[model samples]
Structure formats: C-alpha cells, structure tokens
Target: MKVLALLLASLAAVSAQTEPWCRCAAFVTYEHSEIMVFEAPEVTIDSCTDDAKQCKNSCTKELNDFSNNGNLWLVQENGLTVGQNICTYMADHFFYFIHNHRVYGYFEVCGGAWEYTGVASQQLLCCNGGKHEHCISK
Candidate 1:
C-alpha cells in the first residue's frame, strides 16, 4: 500500500510539472518583410506579471526606436482586460507577428529562453502566400 501511494504521488507531481494551461503561436510574412502577426491563447496578466511589464516596456522602447515605421499590434481572445494588456505589452516589446484567428507559435513567457512549446501549422500558411509548398514536407 505504501509503495502504491508513493507511485501515485510521483505521478501527480510529474503531471503538475507538465506544460502550462495556455497556448501560443507566431508567424512572419514573406521573407520576413512584413510584420504579419502572432497570437496567444487567453493568458492571464498574473501569469506574466514581472515579465509582462518588462516586455511591454521593452516593446515601447523598440517602438520608439522605429518611430514612424514601427508597426505592431496585440489582440486578445477569451481573456480578461489584464490579459489583453499583457498582449499589448508583448507586442510593444517584441516585434511579433499577430493576427485574428491565427497564431504561429506558443511559449511560456516565464519559461527560460521563451521556449517554444508548440506551433500552429495553419498559421504557417500565411508565411509563403498560403502555399505550403516550401514548408518541410512533414
């Protein structure tokens, strides 16, 4: 019985360490010329907290550097007002390609190196003019 309990506890701990609850994706335009768009599932600002604000500030600085030519926007889906704000902050800090109904990649901000968790194939379509011809043939 004790052994079984220990195994169960270990399993639970492993499950908890798995990926996070949210999802995200990113995509760039042809030859990376245009700042197409990137999207993230409903992410709570609390999740980002320190990173969110720092990201937002960084975006603002980048935007200021580009000034007139800078083009970046943030959109939120099924998220709270704070989540929307976090997205905006990210857009301002990192030059991400974001759009409606499409996300290219997902990552956990708190995670180191902004490790990419998953990517959306559908969003990749935007990269090469809706032609998956150049995409890695699976």
Candidate 2:
C-alpha cells in the first residue's frame, strides 16, 4: 500500500508538470472579408515567452539575410522581444502579451496575403483580461 501510494503521487506530480497552462486560439482578420484562425497547443506563460524569444532571434537572422541579399524593405527596427512584453511571430500571424501580467493571450491583425515576414503592415489587437472581456482558458 505504501509503495502504491508513492507511485500514485509521483505520477500525479509528473502529469501536473506536463499539463498545459492554457488552451489558446488566435484569429487573423483581413479587410477583404477573410479570416484565419489558428489553435495553439496548451502552453504556459513561460513557454510562450521562450517561443517569443526564439521567434525574435530567428526573425532577426532572416532580416539580416534579406539585407545581405540587397533587400532593403525589411529592417530590424527594434528587438522583437523587449521590456515587459514579448511578441512571437508564428508564420501568418503574431501574438504579443505582457510578461507577468494577467493576460490570457495576445493577438495581432495580419493583413494582405499570408507572409512569413517578421512584421506585417497590419493593425494590433490585445487581450489582457480586462473588465468585460474574456481570454483564453484551459
């Protein structure tokens, strides 16, 4: 009985660590009556921040490559991950959320045809679990 109890407790701890922090879905709306929605795996805030950092680094590299190739349209204005906020660019869309803030998730409006550019000429939308607002959940 003691061994069984210990085993059960160990399993519970492991499962808890592996569990997702929240279930999130992002939506991108276009001006031409088009919308795209993406479902993200349940991810914790820490993981989200890590993802954003990775994205920033990758995007910076891409920008460098473009500049080296004589493409002047794309430039790294400022670091993507900075201050208390982090923005993660995931292919077609990007998400930004404040670190340590009570935000459920972040969102950005992607314009034009889907592109993998670091930043797009688009609008910004934020969801921080404000009054009369809802956010992502587990």
* Number of the top-ranking candidate, with lDDT as the measure: 1
Which lDDT tens digits does candidate 1 get at residues 15-109?
A: 77743333233434344443324443434334443555444334333333322212222222433222233344445656333333332332444
The whole-model lDDT of each prediction reads 0.37, 0.33
Candidate 1 C-alpha error for residue 118, in Å: 2.6
Residue range 24-118, candidate 2, lDDT tens digits: 33334444642332333333433432344443344334333423322222233552221111133322244333222221122211211222324
| Candidate No. with top TM-score | 1
Question: How accurate locally is residue 69 in candidate 1, as Cα lDDT from 0 to 100?
Answer: 18
Q: For candidate 1, report its TM-score.
A: 0.24
